[model samples]
Target: MPPKQNPDAPAAPDASDALDAPPTTKTPPEVIEFWQETKQTPEELAFYAPEYLCLTILAVILFFPLGLVAAYFSYKTMQDNKQSSWEAAYVNSGRTGWLNVFAILIGLGIIYYALLFS
Candidate 1:
């Protein structure tokens, strides 16, 4: 008689097959946004119209005299060799100094009065 095959035997599971592989990491959206923002150009400065140019010129005119007096005081102090604290004086002098102060309060009292009152 031929040997009978067993019908109740259990099948072995495959060990080489993968069923639970790890997923790849994805990049978050926030980090990708800066590259687009950095490509943008800044807006240009405005400089049209004659009035704007004139106001800029007048501002430079007003600033020049203050700078000149400060420079003159610095020059005089260097010649004297007496501590030469003109840099300190220049810092303390605010916008206008003794030049304008004396010119207004004592010397040309009428000039600033004309500017302010008249």
Candidate 2:
């Protein structure tokens, strides 16, 4: 399907359309001279942002060591709280090490069987 065009626009001009363009008016000589003579304001310089840098560095330094200490303490607490003895922990169906040992043996047996069969 063909697209529609705007009817309000005037008919297209030729290649020399720039020649028919409007003329630009110049500023007054006094205003131009004043602008030329005036010096622009200097931008503010920042020589030291040491506080911001110091804070960022301090946070990075503290976070890692603090997290490590917290993790170490948690692990030590878990290990030291010995209600989790091996026999009691692995006790299920009234068998302590039997099930665990059998499970390990079965896993090893499967690997052995695979090696033998394969």
Candidate 3:
């Protein structure tokens, strides 16, 4: 007796069938651009984002309170840069850098006192 086969099921294509069939052309996926597609203005080109994130992180590690303050200013500086407020960014960047430096210095001073005075 012959084996039972499903008549509704599609048959596998042979090499001859492939040669007879038209080639399928798949459309490429659309490439989307991030932000804007247009060119930036002169001022936008001159964007100076001086957000010292590494220093802020280091400062945070050195001294919690003061480093938190420095991190705040660094965040403000980044916000200012995004808002295109160069003057405000400049002020905030300076404040952030100084605060980080001061925080590091304070940590070093504490260490010095602990080691030498002990």
Candidate 4:
């Protein structure tokens, strides 16, 4: 016969149940704010900013895979800019995109000069 189980003892948690459980950490206030901001209504998001688009296009033309990644972030910035709280993302993306472009330009210049002098 199988051993009798103790009814008073707590049952072991099932692996599947563990997988379904939500994360223990509470969402930070800043993250909640950012999420709420990004969910702004369409009317609020109507204004279109061309900076991200321009940077995305420039990056795609000058760079390749890395440019594509920058373009994705730029696109995200555009979407996030609908609400004032999410403006930081737009600024960050724009700054990164521009920096990437400048870095590539500088690198090309250095390579050109190195080849010329050599």
Please say which candidate is ahead in TM-score: 1 or 2.
Answer: 2
Off-target runs (Cα >4 Å) in candidate 2 are 1-94
Per-residue error at 9 for model 2, in Å? 99
In candidate 4 the C-alpha lDDT for residue 107 amounts to: 54
Predicted candidate 2: what Cα RMSD to the true structure? 30.4
How many clashes does the backbone of model 1 have?
0
lDDT per residue (tens digit) for residues 1-118 in model 1:
9997788977655543212222223535553453243322121111111122232233334445544554454445333322334454334333234443432343244456678897
Ten-residue stretch with the least lDDT total in model 3: 27-36
Q: For model 4, which pairs clash?
A: none
lDDT of 4 by residue, 12-118 (tens): 99966544354345868775565465644444455434445665666666656666777777766665565443566657566656756874675567679889999
Ranking, TM-score, top scorer first: 3, 4, 2, 1
- lDDT against true structure, model 1: 0.37
Per-residue lDDT of 2 in model 3: 96
> Which consecutive 10 residues in model 2 have the weakest lDDT in total?
41-50
Candidate 1, residue 86: CA error in Å? 12
Q: Show how many residue pairs clash in every candidate, following the order shown.
A: 0, 0, 0, 0
Model 3 scores a C-alpha lDDT of 0.78
The sequence of per-residue lDDT tens digits that candidate 2 reaches over residues 23-109 is: 234757765554344321111112111122232233334344433333333333333323333233223212312333344455556
Runs of candidate 4 with Cα error greater than 4 angstroms are 1-50, 83-88, 110-118
2 against 4, candidate with superior lDDT = 4
Cα lDDT listed for each candidate: 0.37, 0.38, 0.78, 0.62
Give the residue spans of candidate 1 off by over 4 A.
Answer: 1-62, 82-118
TM-score per candidate: 0.19, 0.22, 0.63, 0.40
